[model samples]
Target: MIEILSPSRVDRARRTGALVGDILQTLRRRTEVGTNLLTLDRWTKELIEEAGATSCYVDYAPSFGRGPFGHHLCTGVNDAVLHGRPRDQVLADGDLLSLDLAVTLDGVAADAAISFVVGEARPAESVALVEVTERALAAGIAAAQPGARTGDISAAIGAVLTGAGYRVNTEFGGHGIGSTMHQDPHVANTGRPGRGYPLRPGLLLALEPWVMADTDQLVTDADGWTLRSATGCRTAHSEHTVAITEDGPEVLTLPRAA
Candidate 1:
């Protein structure tokens, strides 16, 4: 469903976005070599409960994923990219890590993701992967304005990834998000501009740009949820929930001082 949020709901969305951003930032700060994926999940749950917010993922049951995600956070390590179900894996120095999270507060929801290198070692390839995805996410957000088409956002993101020599995957990308974590108007990572759903004021979209270092193919892990690179190449993902407004696009999921 494509939802144009009410003004009051948009206000609530800001709160929800802030909560999601803050939690991700907090987790990033706490993460280090030896940190377990399951530990991150536990931290997410505690943070969500402390904020009096509900997790958008814990009980999420989507057709593509194993029913009931049963985890509050997605921790993707190295080659693992999307739908990364938290597990017992421990992060190592120089390992690329991606964290995707969503939550609802006051009846509104927000979603966002971030990728970075773990510990003190910053492998050049890992750093580049994270940086490119972040730039793509910024481009996507910049393209999201009132009257702009979703394809414009996709094209903007695609340019960055492709230009950086990374392969984009369209199977799982961004989407309309409001009261729920995922909604209509699927936003692919790459597409021709001037196509797809038209943007308008009050509409919310979660624009994510993700890429694999070598190939566009993906392979699901044995867990039936985590999506990894088919070629075992490192991957990175970046995302944010944006709201269309008269002033252009407002990034609701930007990190703020806590």
Candidate 2:
């Protein structure tokens, strides 16, 4: 379903966005070599609960994933990219980690994701992958203006990822988000401009740009949730929840300090 949030809801959405951002930032600061994925999940749960918010993923059940995600956060390391279910694994130096989070506060929801390297080592390829996704996310956000079509955003993101020599995957991409986590108006990572859903005030969209180093193909891990690169190449993902307004796009998921 597509939801055009009301003014009050939009205000609430800002709060929800801030909470999500702060939690992710906190987790990033606490992560390091030997950090366990479950530790991150626990930290996320505590933060969410402390804020009096609810997790959009904890009980999430969808056809594509194993029912009841049962985790407060998604931790994607190295080859893992999307729907990365937290497991009994410890991070290693130079490991690329991606954290995706969504939460609801005051009846509104926001979603965001960030990918970064752990410890002191920064592999050139890993750094490049993370940088490209971040750049693509920024390009997508820049294209999110009132009256602009979703395709415009998609094209902008696609240009960055493709230009960086990464393959784009459309099977899973950004989508409308509001009171609930995922909504209508599917936003692919790549598409022709001037097509798809028309943007308007009160519309909220989660724009995510993710890519694999070598191929566009993905393989599901035995856990039935984590999505990894077919070639086992490193991957990266960046995302933000944006609200379209008469003044242009307002990024709600930025850290409080940003």
Pick the TM-score winner: 2
TM-score of each: 0.98, 0.99
The clash numbers for all candidates, in the given order, read 0, 0
**What would the TM-score be for candidate 1 when compared with the true structure?**
0.98
Q: In model 2, which runs have C-alpha deviations exceeding 4 angstroms?
A: none
Please, what is the whole-model Cα lDDT of each candidate in the order they appear? 0.93, 0.95
Minimal lDDT window, size 10, model 1:
249-258
Q: Which regions in candidate 1 have their CA more than 4 angstroms from the true location?
A: none
- What would the per-residue lDDT of candidate 1 be over residues 46-113, giving only the tens digit for each residue? 99999999999989999998869999998899999999999889999989999999999998899999
Model 1, residue pairs in steric clash: none
Total backbone clashes of model 1?
0
How do the residues 34-78 of candidate 2 rate in per-residue lDDT, one tens digit apiece? 999999999999999999999999999999998789999999999
